[model samples]
Target: MSLGDEHGFGSESGDRRSDDSFGGSGQTRTRLPGGGDTDVYGGARRPVRNSRSLITVVGVVVLLIAAIAFANQGGGEEGPSGDGAKGTGSQPTAATGVKPVTGKNGQIPTGYAKDEQGAQSAAANYAVALGSDGMFKSATRRDIVQTVHDPAVTDGLLSDLDKAYSADFLANVGLTGDGSAPAGLTFVSRTVPVGTKTTSFAGDKATVEVWCTGLVGLAGPKSTKPVTETWFTITQNLKWVGNDWKIGSSSQKEGPTPVNGDNRASSADEIAGAVQGYGGFTYAR
Candidate 1:
């Protein structure tokens, strides 16, 4: 799962020209239309509003006004602004009036402490849920996507993710074509966020980078996919939505991993047995 040819197998490539699908059919099939032929503003000049044209100038002014109004609204709720821009979740806040942790609709934890530490904790935990094995399944994938991602990006992200988890993609992970467990076997894929750093914070919009270690493989008799560990970094631009941190956008990159010494590799059976026998941890700050 983690060891793959393409980095953005299930992720939406930032390139607007690429056909990046979210969760439509899976990674192997179904390519969603992006900023290529289907993209409306893929041409040169970046489709800027022209000041020479009255209509274009008016449109540009309107957009600027709208953005200002939105930022003002966000700033009001956050009380005050710090070094960075408003509406980003980067500004430091007093812990006063902040409540203890609360679970998200009986699932995730929400309403983190109004301080730097709390935000970091929230980012780490949310990253884990976003990068878990449940993302491969349709039903659980929907829940995790809806819960973790910002609402604005949900539609596009869901579409792209659908294509990322296609039958072929699942097969590559050693699961059945439909992303199910094979008879007498178990599949494992999980992400553990080791730490988090805030890159930018304004209001509810904050960009956090999660240093992570992932475990992925198949555990069962006759299973050739051995569970393996990988180090990577996941960056999430999150927005505070409905009292919880929701991911507005996310991207992954290969790690600052350490070099490995020549070590004896475990047998396939041993790997399978360990994967099936051991459960993952509930990561937190």
Candidate 2:
């Protein structure tokens, strides 16, 4: 079943974080980190000889560097620095450097800025909210859809998701008809976005991709299912809705997943304990 949630959702007109329309060649170049590079000394280098002059120049350069660093201590990211900063999907990259979203609707993040970096932040945080355990319940799921999705598609989305999470589906996932974990077991579902990039953006609309790693399944020694990890990518269609970015729609696919590492897998009790002990974070760009 497509679930319609993955690949089916998109932008109302604008929420942008890209060339794969933000459009064009798809390739991008950045000035470089810390903004750019410059010749501090502003002069050509000499071959071999002047020890005294070299020492004086080095001392001056060091002092200038220290001063510059001190002056730059508190500045925040202006926006997406370039394509590389957001990542290319094949490897890790630095953050888009956009600040975290400032407002939230209940527990769901809200009030995103109207900019590329803002779109990226919206996409990432929305992914987190959607992947949360709340999506499994009737009331909480309704609350989440209303908060993250554009009002135009909200009703249809609710209907589709209700069918998707039907009784049979709940049984398969080990959740009760009401979406509760069986007594003595912990049902865990969490999403952590690894990175985000724009596939297309035109101010009022944006298509962003979020790469994520998640935990799901039941956690308990006697339970038939034990929580496991999953990797997937969510392609979000975003639009500037009211004052914030909201999902037009979304779809999903398998992975840009990494190979499993050598760390030993935890016992079910340990997994359940960990889930109950640790709290999740609110995502940002």
RMSD of each: 18.1, 21.4
Q: On residues 71-159, what C-alpha lDDT tens digit does candidate 2 reach at each position?
A: 10001011111112223222212236655655677666688778877888888877766655665667866887788888887887666
In lDDT terms, which candidate is top? 2
Model 2 misses residue 194 by how many Å?
0.3
The 10-residue segment with the lowest total lDDT in model 2: 17-26
Error of 1 at 36 (Å): 49
lDDT of 1 by residue, 1-285 (tens): 122322221222111111210010111212233323321111211111111111111101111111111000000000111111112322222333454464453244556654555667676766555444555566655776666556776676666555655666555455565556566555555456666788888777777776766555454456544344555555566667877776665545545455443333455456444544444433356
Backbone clashes per model, in order? 36, 20
| Residue 155 displacement (Å), model 2 | 0.1
